[model samples]
Target: MNIDTIELKQQQLTYPQLRKTQQYLMPARLTGNSGQPNGYDIYPVAPLGAGKIFTGFDTLADYIIKTKAVLIDGFGGVFWDKVQQQLQSCFNDKDLSVNWIYTETFLKPTGEIDALVKPFLGADDSVWGTKATFDLIDLFEPAIEQQVPDAKFDINIVIGTGAALAGWASPIIYLDVPKNEIQFRMRARSITNLGNAKVAEPFQMYKRFYFVDWVLLNQHKKNILNRIAVMADAQWPETINWMYQQDLEAGLDQLSRSVLRVRPWFEPGAWGGQWMKEHIDGLNKDVVNLAWSFELIVPENGLVFESDGNLLEVSFDTIMFSNNQHILGKHAARFGDEFPIRFDFLDTYKGGNLSIQCHPALNYIQENFGENITQDETYYILDCDDNANVYLGFQEDIDPSDFRLALEESQETGKAIDIEEYVQIHNAKKHDLFLIPNGTVHSAGAGNLVLEISATPYIFTFKMYDWVRLDLDGKPRPINIEHAFNNLDFSRKGDKVQQELISKPQVIESAPGYQLVHLPTHADHFYDVHRLEFDSSVTVNTDNTCHVLMLVEGQTILLQTADGTQKQFAYAETFVVPAAAGSYKLTNTGSGRAKVIKAFLK
Candidate 1:
């Protein structure tokens, strides 16, 4: 076919590939299951089939028509009505309908795999939302049989978690889209497979769409032309994913180019990419503008301990590159620079005592520590033993000498610090959140499980004491004895331990998650938190600027309208709701109450 002719029919035709066509014409051949008496055996399909297959379609319209878009409404997640309405508005043809399918009846996947949606036409359609989660190859194999029953396409859209890919064990299928799509899908798949085991971001795995763009579009195919781009303006995810892929392929050369062009610096101790300081000296400093910045902190690689301790994960600086790029492009549409979104993450793994230390006063950090010190931290306990305890602020007067003595003794004896003298201890539970402000003498006890969210750049850790855990090489880790001893604020001691309230948090007027009460200084960045209850919807205003919304309880839909355009965000398990999402409403449609937290810049 001529290029023009192919372009004309590309939309409707089964994507043209001579090799794929050959497989589509192959006969129904069963290899491993031939001897089975009955059809009760389950063949573990490859994630990406060993050989290519063909899909039958002649025109784009036919392709879309025969191609079903399965919407599996996972439990604990919500699909906004506005999103439905907006998505519906895009189609000028009135015949097309967006069907809302509830997959609640089928046994829900316990942890991560709460729901699964497969768009099946013909024979495959019956299985389309049949399971809470399923392997993409298995789901599509039958579809291929139904569509191109006589032939196979080299490329097939394999939908499922990363585990599903493993479940099928297919190897070497090239994904056409950006890496993040695969990452997101793999993330979702993992969660769904867990079923209902308190997995976070349950629906994230399925929301990502991966296709072989090279086979369809040219190398220079603009993202704006993608099907998803037609529906939503959030193209950064795809762009970022592509950049990540570029970095992977291009490596140091790309890094050099990035430095020369932007004079940018990566965060120190970065996890996925190179560390920050190593590349700082090579960056170009005379650029007209700096587009993005990433940041992170990594512990010494071989740090080890015999007793239980909390490991602190620091977000590398370059994180801003991702969060800011998205915000400037997406959030700026609604909340402008006035509302800068702050992104912070500490990928921590705890080992032993994180001294009973809290942040210094906000003013203290800003004035003494400099303008970029915002130390209010929120922890979503990631994993912890059943009886682990953390000593948050003190219950009563704790003599400085006594506290020091306790730490010294703990270090000397390799025992947990005597929290009884300085503070009361609360048994740490899984998924509980702790709001640790500056100046609060808190220590994360043994068996730590926490995801910390904080603001700004300053590591003012006035450690009270360390249980003298040795490093991996069997040497003792350093302790901040002088600093810890000097910074302990024994005044206004708080009730040592208090029960955590994880139930649908009480939402007040204009709050998104939890209200962390603390006064802020001029340079301090913070968000008023609110916990959203299921069934009960809340109307939020981004009067200040960008708000970072996290799903703490359940899934939520952040409906946004921009310049007469509206978008709905369903299955936002733990995704960020940009400040530009505008004056939107949050709804909880999951079986249980939705617990969403919103943090907006103030």
Candidate 2:
């Protein structure tokens, strides 16, 4: 799972010959009618194949009956209560309505768990950090056969199949909401039944929903979602659509030759920047600042494919599962079933500094998080201020033990450590690629717009320091000094860091109007980086490997596929050219020189 392996050693990894030795899985892109003038287009299936591609008057009850499941286990973001009512009315079936069970009924009182987590409310612990597990059987035994919630249990006696318990395996139906909508609903307190509590503050409830529920539960329910019967987009009636998993795979197969872009969601954070809010179109402007944009984050990002002039979104995992080799090529065999590369924005323009953090080494991430790959990442400077500086590795070595003591004392006393004394600083400019392998202490200093390119294992940043800044809610953010110290490589100090970690771009190829610069990374880095400096145009081949493109320094550019199909992207826009897309031509539509960063398997 380490992307570094996917980069250097994956050339030897190859998938079995298609249909030669394995089960023949053909292209099965989902196609549907939207009642428009145009014809049908391929569609992405909902996450876990739990929802449907098209809405109908009556289908939920029939689907349950057809699938031969006693109950329909639907779990998702806020507003499920109201969504259930809407589904009941849509189905118009008393039989189906009477069999559904809301998980809230099966809860032990909130006081027991709340008391344990209360101490770390303003400290450095997440709900998952607590050694507490609430199984459905333990809490919902009393409500098993009762109609307490006005729904009689299906006599088949399928127990606790909703949550991520051992016996929960039926036709799962996952309802989903966008991040913006979920946050809004949580803040508005649209519905109660937050595990154990009836009511809580907005920010507190938000933490439970995101950190506890989503992050901690995603892996638990991934198996159920993998073979889901239906996935609902949760937009009732008009736009609400349920998509099948097989159909989604089929749709992805059909799109092997086309480009794919997920509808990115934006979030405003405590150390957020203003670039996204000022430039990115179709974002909620009411937010104070947009810190992170999940540009190519597959697990969380949703895919959008237009069918008959109507745009429908599904989880990006559809293509990862269905079009594996076609999208990832050789790395597909190495990565098996995961998309290895990630493209995300880190905007610090006119904002504060990011947390000084480091990711665990490969073995640490694997042993601790049960992950196959570590987050091997690189930060390509997309834009930056005149005085922008990036924190990487450490300054000239002093004492590793002393550094740990200083960090701990700062955490205990609410005092800020002088970051420069221990951390190395490098001035950043446009197109400066800083190599941040796992365990390299790094941070995106303020006044720079960074395009973080890496193997997608985000959320593992073990923050050692946060510059003594408070969160958006005015509470001190969490810092993991112990975890950071355990993973920090003091050997990556002063001279070795600059000579090994910091990238130095070399012009590998130069022509009249085009030059390809090789931005060499660390030996452990599984992915390679390159800058396509072009004047008028340049032709780039996928080489049977997926290529992620970013318009780092240009107003706009055109990507022309082999079929002569073309797509234009503006400045700071990120897009992907699939492995099946073959060779594509890039025409610089801007006035001056254009630099597009192409990242893929080495």
Candidate 3:
């Protein structure tokens, strides 16, 4: 039955007015057990030595004055105007001889940059783009060296996103902002894409940032990690948190050998749901709905560290950049700094069905998108109503030409086609694992909370249909029938989908009050899944590979790492166990059996 025809009871539609008790939305790994858990500390700080960190702009300026010259390099979306004003004010009070050089002066013209990135930006409204091969250096003018003043001053400050390329042999202070904050700034029109002076529309701006700017900046950040003398959290406007590079590296090293949890962020969408808003505490209830929780999508998430109650958050990439080998272990050689696995939430509970979509094949993605990996994904139903369903694969008599014609006609006439006539629909149940390898057609229907496990290359969805609904901004979402047709696997239809796509659970190991069940993934996937069920406690070995896990069934569980460090995780909370963490133990803190779903690179 279609989503519109499905009858849901009134009780199924009513969400609990009270938030889920003891549901810890902001989970963090602490350096020690001395500090109390604070769900409100979004920017947790890792402790550092006494002389390593500088708090305010005044303190940062004092440290800068000690050196003759310094280059302040950072990511895009930074408030360069605020940085200039604050530092300039501090320097003037000290009567220091300062020559301030803003990197914007050396940027190539906007038209030149637009032309350079046009090939990668795709169409005006297209969501997908090939990864750019250009570097941060290419965005600057060839005569950047000449732009620097030859005369010497007491303190020469060169600052901006690409300030380090200004031909300065000075101490570099890198300012870092998380990806979520950057998107928020984009929505507020307070920042522009790299090398562009005026902010484009939010959606178009994000498209450019994801396809071009972020690609180049991430490479630049990785290149400069070793050279940065100081790392600053630039999310805040007036105040700043600066720490010595050595200390930041130390914190990363500590985390590589222990369990780590990347901070999760939530966003509202047109197909958003009330599950997260009602269950996840600390989330703002004023929004229309919380559709997706970026549980552990490392590309856009951040890792927060707490040091003496002060918090600092850095982009999750810094962890891989600093210690990929320790974090990924044997898989490090193949993936390098890229985290191969991703875990996120697709909350459609009491909302709408996700867009009927399919991802590109490995060869298609690598050739056309400049990506090393494709978006191979699986949906684990975390929770669902009685009538919840998942649309997967195709009908037995499906015809590609007819399907394409119907989709195109719908796009043209704004008419709804009977999607189930072509796509297979399966009843979704809690803990049902649905495998969606690259090129597989699939989508989570309404009234279900889905824990999406996949590879790291997200945002490559080739949508064929979107239920003929306008997006949150009252605009039609993009449809990619041609792209979907290029990748859709017609052979995965009828009974074959039920036999292959739906995983069968088999108990692999069991003991008194404990059982380990293997939820096998598709052969095309590079990762595997396991569900650990225990009433008291269970011990698991990392097996020299990283493990991404979530407490799916129970209310609370305590995780103890190999080094005897312990942390508590609540239901639906996601955390990572690095390869170097060795073995860990989980003890049920709440009553009843606790089940944790574990995903690791095979």
Best by lDDT: 3
Per residue, candidate 3 scores C-alpha lDDT tens digits across 388-441 of 999999999999999999999999999999999999999999999999998899
What is the C-alpha local distance difference test score of each model?
Answer: 0.33, 0.64, 0.84
Worst 10 residues of 2 by lDDT: 18-27
Which predicted model would earn the best TM-score? 3
Model 2 regions lying over 4 Å from their true place: 1-75, 91-174, 178-231, 235-239, 243-247, 563-565
Candidate 1 per-residue lDDT over residues 453-529, each given as its tens digit = 45533345565555455433355544554555545556536442343212223424434432332222112225445
Query: In candidate 1, residue 545 scores what lDDT?
Result: 47
Evaluate model 1: give its TM-score.
0.40
TM-score comparison, 2 vs 3, better candidate: 3
